[model samples]
Target chain A: DQQVKQNSPSLSVQEGRISILNCDYTNSMFDYFLWYKKYPAEGPTFLISISSIKDKNEDGRFTVFLNKSAKHLSLHIVPSQPGDSAVYFCAAKRRGIQGAQKLVFGQGTRLTINP
Target chain B: EPEVTQTPSHQVTQMGQEVILRCVPISNHLYFYWYRQILGQKVEFLVSFYNNEISEKSEIFDDQFSVERPDGSNFTLKIRSTKLEDSAMYFCASSGDAYNEQFFGPGTRLTVL
Candidate 1:
């Protein structure tokens, strides 16, 4: 069973525009959420994260909004650059299913930034 | 900036051969994890380690798989009997604290024939 889902397989945006990537999860146990960006052949790199207690968290040009009640989260990259073109994955973590628990990940959505 | 790193970048092995993938997690990090991503698939957690012991593991991590912090700076994953289905990119990650962002290594692409 997939607890985290990125319904969209791909997203494209004009350079310098805002790009929004959406994610939904079915597990109510998930309390922390994170977004990762990946280029081919490299590992996923951490972007931003938001806990269930907070509605939003922002880091530089990246912002992540979490709606706990809706079990939804979105990552927004403003003034998207060509470098931002990559695969984006949404991940979720519960407090403790096991000690030092692990994060459950979405299938990932490929984002393309058009110049 | 310190980063996690893996060795052999890519490994090719025959079926049923034992393969060991090595990782050097960031120093000062207490939590370490192993995750795998099949082509075009989500990254799935395999195991988590802390204090030289396994803290958590998924069903996918069967007896065929083992993890160890054999020394002060190295963490390793050993697959006892490789299978074609085991072919995928394996990533090693480490975090300073629980629930914090984990830094991942470039990954070791394992191809089992």
Candidate 2:
């Protein structure tokens, strides 16, 4: 079962504009959410994260908002730059059946920032 | 600046041959993990290791898959018999604590032909 889902397969935004990527999860047990940025032929790099306890978390140009009631979260990048063009993945960590740290990931959304 | 490192950026092996992927996680980090991503797919967790033992594994980690921490700094994943379906980019990650964020390696592209 896909516990995490990124409905939008791709997104485009003009440079200096705002870009928003959305993600949803089916598992209510997940409490920690994270966003990762990946470039071709490279491993994903952590961008930002938010805990269920907080509704939002901001890191410079990136902000993540979580809505527990809706089981949804979003990442917002302000003043999007061409460098921001990459695949973004949403991940959630939940206690596994064996009480282990298991991260469930979404399919990923390809973000393209036009110059 | 302590990041995870993986060897052999790319590997090509014949089907049914055994292959070993190596990783060296950051020093002082305890929790280690392995994840794989097929082209155009999301990253899937394969296994997590702690205290020199496997803490968790997904269904994808079947009989052909195994992990070992042969020494203090090296972690390895072994595929007893590689299949074409096993071709993917395998990533190694490490975190200092269970709830902490993980750092990932550049990834090793394993192509089973």
Candidate number of the best TM-score:
1
Query: Per-residue lDDT for A31-93 in model 1, tens only?
Result: 889999999999999999998889999999999999988999999999899999999999999
The residue ranges of model 2 lying beyond 4 angstroms of the native Cα positions read A95-98
Q: Which docking category, incorrect, acceptable, medium or high, applies to candidate 2?
A: medium
Question: Residue A20 error for model 1, in Å?
Answer: 0.3
Q: Please, what are the lDDT tens digits per residue for candidate 2 over residues A46-101? A: 99999889999999999999999999999999989999999999999973334468
lDDT of 1 at A91: 94
Which digits, one per residue and each the tens of the lDDT, describe model 1 over residues B1-113? 99999998999999999999999999999999999999878899999999888999999999999999989999999999999999999999999977778889999999999
Query: Mind listing the fnat for each candidate?
Result: 0.79, 0.62
DockQ of each: 0.73, 0.64
Let me know the DockQ for model 2. 0.64
